[model samples]
Target: MANHHIDIHHVAKLARLKLSDSEAATYTLQLDHILDYIAALDQHDLDAAMPTAHAEAVFDVWRHDEPRPSFTNEQSLANAPKKSQGQFQMPRVVEE
Candidate 1:
């Protein structure tokens, strides 16, 4: 795949494409047969292929940080429409 010579009208003038010299000779022979089938898959020989990031031996189970309780600041301000010294006030959303 590195013998590189693919100028389909300079790649349709860098993708602002308006190609039609028979669509740049049919996309330069369909990108030279998909780059000669990826140069025949670069002469295939993966040396017993086994370099995986994730073909699913999945992980990240995460749950055991241990802190189980419940809320109480006066039962969480009991449904505040504007609490003050214990918190939940909302209205001065940044302008300055």
Candidate 2:
């Protein structure tokens, strides 16, 4: 287990969270415990093991690329911040 004190306030600020002093202390301990658990993996010898994303065999089960019904132009443009002539309007992206 790692013996390091975490700066909970810094973490909370970065995550845009407003944590009280008690909450910060609680989270600090919880985060430290999680990190200590992860550090325990260092004791394992993983040289012979193959890295995998999952423990079991996984195959791509993809749906066929076929035409399907989609939202209409009105439905698509309904949420546009700025629109004109049935299309999204934005500042010019290129200069002549």
Candidate 3:
């Protein structure tokens, strides 16, 4: 439903791209041809076709959530570059 000629120029300007005159002309023709093909497809009748949610039928594919043991504070901080009071320490992140 969109005009490809003006759309190309608009997109190029928004993206701060500079295309040669020859390149713009070439792309305009190519894009128009592609849109024409899509327009041709719009004439097909799909009124009786059933809409599909997915390409294939899905089965029970989810994994069951299970509880697992987690590392303690001391174990988690064991490999840190620096630690303080049983916790990992890092450089200040914010500046005044």
Candidate 4:
């Protein structure tokens, strides 16, 4: 990867952030440093390295299914700020 500069004003606009001239200048250098680090990482050799799916090995670590005592409906709803019947009430959500 070649060294490149990020357009701080454009980035700020995309992220809906307001930055002063000094802040934009500071962030431009910081973003450039980050990109430089990524470029350096891209030059690493990994031909013989095994790909790891996760940071640590994961096996049958789940608990076996077993019945356990749980809070009753009344107990569950007792602390809710809003409740309807025996269930917690929530505000309606609108989806795009």
Candidate 5:
């Protein structure tokens, strides 16, 4: 990879960050290191490799999404502090 200089101030501005000159310099070196690592990874011979979300295959561990028994309307509202028209009553929130 070419030695591309990253504009730390520009990056910080885009990310809505307030970085000082020293901080920007530190981040620039860190970003350069990260880019170097990526460059090294690009040298790997993996033309036959298929892209995947994970390094290894992953199977779903969840159970089947089948419907189960639920509470009746009266049973659901039975413990409510206030109820009207078979529903929980909440205080008015909006003003006229």
Candidate 6:
């Protein structure tokens, strides 16, 4: 992806950043290191590598979803800190 060098000043301007000389230098070095690492990874031999979703084998550990008994109104509101007319109450969140 990184075929060309990154222009730190151009990138800063595009991002609306007002980077000082020191900041630009630091970012340039960091970007160069990242691109160099990617270049190194590009040298790997992967012709025989198989595409996979995960590095290790994985399986579904979830349980079946089945219908169950429902809770009563009172049971559902048992732990409510504030309730009115058997319903939970909270601060108004909407505006006119």
- Rank the models by TM-score, top first: 2, 5, 4, 3, 6, 1
lDDT of each: 0.81, 0.88, 0.81, 0.88, 0.85, 0.86
Off by over 4 Å in 4: 45-96
The C-alpha stretches of model 2 lying farther than 4 A from their native spots are 5-18, 69-96
- Model 3 lDDT vs. the true structure? 0.81
TM-score of each: 0.23, 0.48, 0.39, 0.43, 0.44, 0.37
Better of 1 and 4 by lDDT: 4
Using lDDT as the measure, name the better of candidate 3 and candidate 6.
6
- Over 1-96, each residue of candidate 3 has an lDDT whose tens digit, in order, gives 435444778878998989998988778788887887777756988788998889998978986699777898878988999989887789899997
Task: List candidate 1 segments past 4 Å from native.
Answer: 1-21, 28-30, 51-96
The segments of candidate 3 whose C-alpha lies over 4 angstroms from its true place after superposition are 1-6, 14-17, 47-96
Candidate 6 is scored at a TM of 0.37
Write out the backbone clash pairs for model 4.
none
Per-residue lDDT over 1-96 for candidate 5, one digit per residue giving the tens place of the 0 to 100 score? 336568888888899999988999888988977887677767888888887888778688787799988899999998999999999999898997
- Output the worst ten-in-a-row residue range by lDDT, candidate 4: 1-10
Give the per-residue lDDT digits (tens) of candidate 6, residues 16-81. 999999999888888977887778766889789888988787798876699778899999999999
lDDT of 1 by residue, 1-96 (tens): 335458888777888989878878777877887887788766988779888998888799788899978798878988998889998889899998
- Cα displacement (Å) at residue 84, model 5: 30
lDDT of 4 by residue, 16-93 (tens): 999999999888998898988778756889787999999989987987699889999999999999999899999878
Compared with the true structure, what per-residue lDDT tens digits does model 2 show for residues 1-96? 447667889878899999988999788988888887787878999989988987788799888899989999999999999999999999999997
Span of 10 residues, lowest total lDDT, candidate 6: 1-10
Name the TM-score of candidate 4: 0.43
For candidate 5, list the clashing residue pairs, or say none: none
Worst 10 residues of 3 by lDDT: 1-10
Pairs with backbone N, CA or C atoms under 3 Å apart (clashes), candidate 3:
none
What total of clashing residue pairs does each candidate reach? 0, 0, 0, 0, 0, 0
